[model samples]
Each structure stands twice: as C-alpha cells, then as structure tokens.
Target: MIRKLALITPWPDQRTGIADYAFDLAHGLADVGIELDVFTTCTKPSRTISGVRIQDIDKFPGTFAFDQTVYQMGNCSTFHGEQLPVLFENPGIVHLHDPALHHLIAFFLYRDDTQDYYRVLRAWYGARVAERVQTFNELNNQGFWDSPHVTEVPFFDPVLEHATGCIVHSAYAQQAVHSRVPNLHIRQVRQAYRNMQPPAKYNDGEVLQLGAFGMVQQHKHVDVIIEAVKRCNAEGKRVHLHVAGALESVCKDLPDLAKSLGIENDITFHGRLSEEEFLYWMNNVDICVSLRFPTMGETSAVVSRALQLGLPTIVNNVGWYAELPSCVTKLPTEHDEMLKQLVAQLQRVSTNGEQLAQWRAQCRRYAQTTGSFEQTIQDYVRTLACFRTSAMAA
Candidate 1:
C-alpha cells in the first residue's frame, strides 16, 4: 500500500531554521520514495519550490510579521494550517519543528489590533490579554521540556502515538517531546549539512574578515561580536566584520554601534542579502560567527550551511556546536587569548587547508552518514508505513 506522510512546519520559508529543515527533510523523504506533502505558511504570493510539493499556508492571519528570512526563504504557519488535517488524515508521522511557542507568542504580541496580528487574537487588553499573554509568556520564560499545557492538552498524544512517530533535531528537543508524553518512538536528528560550496579560507596577517548573520535581536548578542572585533582591531589587528540579514529595526543602531567603537570603517553592515549576496559573504568570510547567548542551546541551521560550504565557523559554546565542528575555539573570556585563538584558526584554515579539508570531510561524512537526503526520506517513509498499517487495521 502506498503510504502518505505530512510534515508540518508552522512557519514561513524566510523565517528559516525549522522551515529550511522542513524543506530539506522533505527532499530527503522524497529521495527515499516516500509520498509526502509539505504544508507551511508563506507570505510572498504562492510559489512552488523544488523537491517536495509545497502547500502554501495563508498569511491572512500572520502574527510574526517583523520577520525577514536572512539565510534562506521565508516560512509561516504551514504546520498550523495543516495540523487538524494531519490529525484527521492521519499521516504516518508528523514532525513538529518545536512546539507552537513562537507562533503563540507572535500571535499574542504581533497579532494585536495594530494590524493583521490582532485579528486572530483570542484576547487583548485588560485581564483577558494579561491572562492569554501570561500563558505564552510563561512558556517562553520557563523554556521547553517543562510546560503545563504540553501534555495537559490532548492533541499532543494523538500526534505522538497514532500519528506514526515524531522527529526532532536535538537532545533537548527530543526530551521536550518525551516530557509531554514519555517513551515516544521519536528520532533525535541533528541539523543537516547544507548543499553549499566552501570559500577560500583566509590567513593570519590578512584582514580577519568575520561574517555575522541574523537580525540584530537583543538575544542574539550581535553587539558582543562588535566589541570583540573592536578589541582585536585596537591591538593593531586588521579585522573586518560583515553582517547579513534584515536591518528593519536595527539599521540605526548598527551604524551607531560601529561609530561608538570607532570602527565604523572596519565593519560593513550589508543591510540584507539576496541568495547570491548572502552566499558571497558566507563563502568568502574568514570566520563565520554566531554568538548565541544562552538561548536554549538550540543548534543553528546557519552553522550547518557554513559547514556544507566548508567555511570554518565560531559559535558560542552551545549544546551541539561544540560537537558540530571538529575544530572550534570556545567563546573567549580574556580578550588577548581569544584573539590569539581566532587568528590561529584563521591561519590554520588558510595555510593548512589540508587540515581544514579533513574536518570538512568529516562534515561531509557525517552528513552522508546521518543527514543524507535518503536517511531523512526513508525514516519518514517507515513512520508512514507503520501509520498506514495501524490505521487500516483499525
């Protein structure tokens, strides 16, 4: 019997991370001949993407509008729109990127009377808004794996049990699902190695070029990178920092940041990048840096992209990043030593391409072993096969 699988990613393409995950996983599932339909929300007038059949989720009720998909395409409520359909249709498995906290919060804050966000809001202002916002706020505040509504809500169980199985990227994520309902036959997957080409790595004496992606979100620690670069430059080090992604809310602040550090010329803020521009910075960048300041240790798909390109990356010591790269220098406490390691890595990457090549090979090998398109598709297919067998028996 032919089995059908539905992967629900509740965000638009440009929102990226899980959305890119949904796309890549869909391709992987399709590579293994699994019948799958990708349901996710997109805002940029419905367009069909390569690999899987994309079902465009309506944006009439968009609450997460301050978004610009920096690394890749935009993503929205494809999962949310298709959630009920997934339940009734009963696909073999339904892989959630994570719980709907981002959606819930976006709906609470962005979904208010100011614009399209407010229309879908169940409560606004006074006690009702306070109560509704409080619930979502608590979810964010408390973090995942331990939430009141996780299992208290019945919808989770059917999705966990009867819906084939679940797939998550990290141990923390897997644990969160298990916490909602114990012993879920879940597959703990990591972020996939992207399909990209590496840039020519740079050296010690050459200008140390650093590329930082994502918006200037307060939580992302973009400022910390600037400060570190400034310190490096102050000590007669040639450092150039390039930032990609949207500057919607952060443009004014970005220039001021450089000016305040007196390194405005040292840093170039590329407002936002198209596919080509983004890749240019990514491929040419001497060091790909992502400073995630204690933000739940979630792994970055962007880092995966860099790995695919064979660009050496430097990320804050988060859950899997330490393990992701064979050669990684942890975020430095002392400015002098940190700069020394940073320069050393750049030299090794540039002069010692052979060593870097070995690490890159490891990256490719790991992707082939654990993250290949075939692995993704086959697992998804197997999950669906099980779901079909059980459903038909019922």
Candidate 2:
C-alpha cells in the first residue's frame, strides 16, 4: 500500500557514515519503483540519485501526506538537529543509528542552559543519574560535554518520544531501545552493504598489511592496535598498519603514539579518505583491526565493508561486534587479554596461510548472505507498508 516515501537523513558531502548509508539506500529504493523524496539538512547536496529527488528538510510540508516518512537518526547533533522538530510535529519511523544519544541531546538540546539540561536528565534517567551528572559537572566543568557522563549514558528518551516506529541496525540497539521505551514499535535490520567479491589472493609480501577504518576516535582503540602490531613484529612477524578514515582533533595523538611505541614506520595514518581511496586501501589490506570498546551501541560500517570485500576483520567482544559471524576475529574485553589476542591473531594470520584463506572465504559467504542492499530495500518497503496499514486503521 506504500506508494511514495519521504526519507530524512544527512546527504553526501557531509562526510558522515550515515550520509553514505542514506545515499546508497535512496538509490536502492528508487530502483525498486518507489517514488522517493529524500530530505536532508544540507542546503546543497553534492551528489544525487537518478530517480530520487533530494531537497532541504526545511521545505518539507506541514501535512503528513506521504505513505511513510523515515527519519535517519544518529548521534550527531549537526546532522540530525533540524530533523527533531519535524519528527515532533509529524511522528514517523525513526531509523535509530546509535542507541546512546546522550552527546547529541546534551550538545544540541541543552547546550546553552545548564540547569535545564540537568532537569531533563533527571526526568529521563531518574534522580540518581542526575546527581551523578551534577557531580560530574562540578569536577569537570571545563570538559563536561565529552566526558563519560555524555558518552556513556543513553539520553535518548526525549528524541524517541514522538517516533511512531523505530528501525535499529543491531541487536544491541534494538534491545536498548525496547528496554527503555517498552511500548515503542521497533525492528532490527542488520546494516547493509554492497555484495563485493573478495580479492583473488591476499598480498604475498613479507610484511603483513593491517587496516583500521572509520572515524579514528578514542573509542576505536587504534592505540592498542598499534601496540599489538609492535608485539607481532617482536614475535618475528613483520606487520604494517594502514589507517584510513576521518582523523579529527581527538585523533591527533595517534601518530605520536605510534612513534612512542617505536612502530612509526609500521603504521600510516591516512586522514579523511575519499570513497575511491578508502576502497582501494580496503581491497589491499591483509586484515582489518577495527577494534572498538565502550561502544555507544552503534554498528560498524567498516566491519561490514571488510566482510563484503572478503577481508578478515578483528573487533572486541562487546556490543554489536560480538554478534558478528565467525569470519571476524573477536578479541577479549579485558585490556591485557585483548592485547595478547590481537598479537596472537596477527601472528596466526601471518603464518597459518590455510586458516587465513578459509577466513577470507567465510567472510565473503557471510557478507553476501546476510546484509545485502536488496534485503534492506525490501525490509524498508515492508515495514513502511505495515505502518501505513496500522495508521489507516487507528
């Protein structure tokens, strides 16, 4: 019964992972004969899909006339701030990209008013969390925004208050949303990726090539990966790491850390790569060390990309990463155990050529079977149709 669809997300040229995801989903939806109006915060979208009409979200009408409206909600305030008001006025199916929206709400909703922020926290998270926030504010007044209070807590109740239904990409995210807002309609859809064929053969060079992709932030555990690579070298295995992704101010210490560990030459930090450049490096790497810890209940697009490309990926045994298939190498949660696991993994993949080949094959098979773009398009259409039918009845 769904005819026309309205999609709200950050468009390309914004340089965010969600932007890229929206771009691909828009194209896939258009290909399936769906009439689409893609709304974004960007005044001028740098790229466009052939049958999809891209427009600024400000132009969205006051009336809720579309068959269904889908709002892509993530943890970035700059990208998702404007969409919140529209969501409140006309509730829609919100694609919850990150379960923890503490930073986004803290930065965008209550940035100017300190007291109001605490009041809202108390209302959403109870008095205990509010007291903790007050103590945190007193101790770290200079750097409270990026502190653990903002990063760890899930202050997402306000944003999801008006959402008619929710789409989450991981089991962790689905559970987080349902547990917090028990009555909300929620669906779990694995993040999709293009089905790519694995490389015929990995690099046969002496130095093992490792890659760590996505935003190089503190949570990514890139520093630990660097030390792991150094340990691998010490164990008589030559290893080199290639990091490709957005390198913001928070990641400035990574290069210096590499130098301190005496693995400067073994690692290269390529900041903010273009799509072509990113794919090029991904295709060439032997294994991906995309470790994440203290996760915000977010899924990894880099891990998806690595899987489809038939490249083995290494992730910590936590959050959504733990739910990934056996193709990925899951390290321990403890720091010391993780370091030992990473070193052992790198060494094993380097020497045990047969096991490495089996892992690469497994990755391609799993990636093609589970999270294809075609499945994503179908899931969206089906979910929208069901919601439309429910709306008509209610």
Candidate 3:
C-alpha cells in the first residue's frame, strides 16, 4: 500500500558497507516499481541512480511528501554523521544495521554537544545509566578504555522509542531489541548481496588461497587466522592468506605480528580494493575465514558476498553468524580453541577434495535460495506494506 517513499542512507561513493547495501536496495526497490527519493549526506550535487532520485540530506523538506520515510542507521560516524540528528528529529521507520548505538551517540555528543548528550541519556535511560555513561567517558578520557567487550547496555532505546517500526537483518538483533522494548514492531529481513555468477570450481594442484575481507580489526581475529596458516605451513601444506580491506588503526600491528610469526611471506594485504578488484579476489580464493568475538549483533555483508560467490566461509559461533547454515563452518568461541579448530579445518579442506566440493555446492545452493536479491527485495516490499497498513489502522 506504501507508494511514494523516502530512503535515507549513505551512497555508494562513500565506499562503506552500508553505502553499497543501500545503493543496491534502492535499485532493487525501483525495479519492483516502488517510487523512491533517495537522500544521502554526501555533499555531491543531486543526481539519479537506477531510476531513483538522489538528493543531499540537507535539502530534505521540513516535512515528507512520501507515505513514509526509512532511515538506514548504523554506528560508523563517517556515514552516519549527518543522519543522526535527522533521525532523532524526523522519526520514522528505522532499519538499524547495528544493535548498539552507543558509539554513534557518544561520538556526536562528545564531539559536538556534551550537554545535549547527557540530557538525552538521562531522559532515555534515566540517571543511573547516564551516570554509567559519564563514568565510561571519564575512563576514556584517561586513556583506559581499550577493552574489546561490547557495552551490556545498548543505547538504541531512544531511537526505538520514536520509530514507527523497525527492520533488522538478523533474529539475534530482533531478540536483543525486543528484550529492551517489549512492544515494538520489529521485522527480521535476510541481508542481500549483489547477484553474482558462481565462480568456477578450483582445480587440483593450485595453491590453497584463504581470504579475509572487510575492515581488519582485532575483534575480527585476522591475526589468529595468520597463526592457523602458520600451523598449516609448518605441517607441509601450501596455503596463503589474502586480506582485502583497510587495516583499522587498532589492527595495524597485524603485519608486524605476521612477520614475527614467520608467515609474512605467505600473506598479501590488498587494502581498500575497488569493486572489480574485490570480485576478482572472490573468484579466485579457495575459502574465506571471517571470525569475530563479541559481535555487534550485525549481519556480515562480506560473508554474504562470499556465499553469493559460492565460497565456503568460516565464522565464529556467535551472534548473527551463528544463525548461518551448517555449510558455513563455525569455530569455537575460545581463541586458542578457535585457532586449533581452524587449523584442523584447513587441513581437512586441503586434503579432502570431495568435502571441499560439497561445501562449495552447499554455498551455491544457499546463494540461489535465501541470499537471492529478488527474494530480499520482495521481503522488504512486503514488510513495508504491512508496516503501512498497521500505521493506517492505528
């Protein structure tokens, strides 16, 4: 029933994950006959993408002309910097990409308006929560806030209070948000990747290539994969790790760690790749190792891309990744155990061609079914229609 709609998200030129996702979603929705006016924070002049109109966020009219407005929300400041205030002021359906908004909220408040931050925190979560946030900030000021643990109290409640409905990419996110706001309407949609032809199966006698994509950080456990690769090499298996993404500041030490571990020669860092270059690596890699601990309750677009390319992936058994099909290998939570298991998996995949082939087949089947672009777009349209109907009824 929803006809004209406003879609707010970062555009593809930003080169962020959500930017690419939003770009594709906009195109898909347009293909399905939805009228969309896409708004981005990018300062570039207005243009059109895939038949949908794109405009700067600052030009958004004080009131919407569409049936509803959709905000694609995330924690990263680079993309969400200008969208945060708009989200709070013009409440609408929110597609929350991450469960915790603490980082996003804190960045805006601490950098721009500290008083408003405190006032909003007190209003949303009460004085005790505000006090805890203040104490956390004090520790951060003293250079003592370096832990990898996620905040137990996510700061997304304020946004949820104003949302007409919510869309999350995973059940874990749905449950987490619902636990906090029991009556909120939350819909879980399968995250989508661009449709791709399945890469040709690797032939025998080629060196096994392992890939780790996206932002490299300590939590992503890129270093652990290096250690596992070292173990595989020590055992006489010829394997190489090809990392494709920007190295986060915290994980800049990864190259040094690899050199110290004597596996520097077996790894290649392809930082900030273009779309074609990324797809080239995807077509060539044998397997993908993407593990994370203390997940942000967000789905992995990289893993979804791997599946779409018919590549087997290994992820830690936590958060949204845990919900992936069994074809995607899940490692144990403990670091030491995860490394050992990864080594074992590498050995098995290298020695057992049949099992590897089966894994690739399973990935292809999953890509064709649950990860299809058509299905994702249909689900989104249905969800939006239902949300509109409910709003009208109320």
Highest TM-score against the true fold, candidate: 2
Please identify model 2 stretches exceeding 4 Å from their true place: 140-152, 200-203, 388-394
How do these models rank on TM-score, best leading?
2, 3, 1
Span of ten consecutive residues with least summed lDDT in model 2: 385-394
Error of 3 at 379 (Å): 1.0
| Candidate RMSDs in order | 8.6, 2.5, 2.9
Deviation in Å, model 2, residue 273 alpha carbon: 1.0
lDDT of 2: 0.81
> For each predicted model, how many residue pairs clash, with residues at least 3 apart or on different chains?
22, 0, 0
lDDT of 2 by residue, 295-331 (tens): 7778888887787777888998888899888888899
lDDT of 2 at 297: 70
lDDT of 3 by residue, 299-333 (tens): 88888888777789999999889998878999987
- After superposing candidate 1 on the true structure, give the runs of residues whose Cα lies further than 4 Å from its correct spot: 1-3, 10-14, 43-52, 56-92, 99-164, 197-205, 248-252, 332-394
Model 3 deviation from native, Cα RMSD in Å: 2.9
- The Cα RMSD of model 1 versus the native structure comes to 8.6
Minimal lDDT window, size 10, model 3: 142-151
